[model samples]
Target: MYYKYPNGDEIYNVMAVYEAHEVYGIPRINDDEGLELRYFSLDEPIEELNPFTEYYLRKAGYINKW
Candidate 1:
């Protein structure tokens, strides 16, 4: 996905999916209407992940920056 900001700045899309499995790169699910996405996710927690909570955030290994 890709889009230009209101300021007309063209930007690459990026999304950190909780489980960026090889199967999760569908061009549609992460595809937004106007914005782009650099989609990504984990590969091990597909069955153990909780999308309704921050389980992904912590397991994503970026909690130190949080």
Candidate 2:
């Protein structure tokens, strides 16, 4: 899955989708994707994600205000 940032930068392979709390279970791979990633807490529900992640999550059928 490919997605674009708000600045119009494009990213290839949006990677895997997992439940928010399950994120830690995901393996840490090399920086092959070249993305600068940061962890956010879905438990908070009030936190907002970057546009690209939000868009990808929505397209993947994950619905949340953030």
Best by lDDT: 2
12-61, model 2: which lDDT tens digit per residue? 86456556554555455587975655565543542555666677767775
TM-score of each: 0.22, 0.33
lDDT over C-alpha atoms for residue 38 of model 1: 44
Model 1 stretches astray by more than 4 angstroms: 20-66
Q: Please report, in order, the local distance difference test score of every candidate based on alpha carbons.
A: 0.49, 0.62
Tens-digit lDDT track for model 1 on 1-66?
467899999977555545443554346444455564344343334343344334546666633343
Clashes of 2: 0
Cα lDDT, model 2, residue 37: 53
Off by over 4 Å in 2: 1-16, 20-46, 64-66
The TM-score of candidate 1 is 0.22
In model 1, where is the ten-residue run with the lowest total lDDT? 40-49
lDDT of 2 at 38: 55
How many clashes in each structure? 12, 0
